[model samples]
Target: MATFETEFLFVYGTLMSGVDNQWSLRLWRACGQPSEAKVPGRLYTLGGYPGMKDPLDGEAAWVHGQLAQLPDSPALLADLDAYEGDEFVRLRRTATLRDGRIVPVQVYMYQPEVDENQRIWSGRFTFAQ
Candidate 1:
């Protein structure tokens, strides 16, 4: 199984504010320096949900999310898969944030390319917005 080395996940999706969501507080007990803040990357709305894309790409946009210093990224990725209905796949990617710092981040990608009409978004993000 592919595992991620970082604890921070750049969530630019429904997991943000308003829409509806949150990680278990129990899980947060072990979650580290999520306190380290960085508005790193651009957010885009696909369908109705947010998509964290490449900042270099002119098409990229940004939204709000959080920098969670999770201790276990692989487990977190698993939880994310389930949270996203077991279909969302995590891809290890690099993102350059609005602050000009580059960091290695994990992004979850949902397959089959959901259409705009079917996409549901929270509008407020924890990362890019």
Candidate 2:
């Protein structure tokens, strides 16, 4: 029965819940609880964090993560973009929600080519505690 603002985002790495760069929680909190979603892409390890490489080849591969319905805050988006830096580029893409709804969201994609060994075979990436 709660209505949330519609600037959604898909986060799979540090920006995810309970990760190191959780400073983004301020933005996440403004959005409300994140829901599980899947996007077309592959997850790869980039040193200490993970990155998403969108195949753009339809849904052949999928990267699993949470979809956060963020508020339309320019400052917050700018902060996130700056935090992601040049390694990740933000893009708008469709994601399949847990309940089978497909919606467009802002996704930070990894822009570098990675070795096959660096890839996460499960399509899901998380920090090992």
Task: Compare the candidates by lDDT and give the number of the best one.
Answer: 2
CA shift of 55, model 1, Å: 8.5
Candidate 1 per-residue C-alpha lDDT over 1-129 given as tens digits, one digit per residue, 9 for 90 to 100: 247675466555565323344654433545543433333344445544555433445533343454555575466567666776644567676545557666777666544544455322433443333
Candidate 1: count the clashes: 16
Cα distance off (Å), candidate 2, residue 37: 0.3
Give Cα-based local distance difference scores for all models.
Answer: 0.51, 0.80
Off by over 4 Å in 1: 14-27, 32-58, 73-76, 116-129
Top candidate when judged by TM-score against the true structure = 2
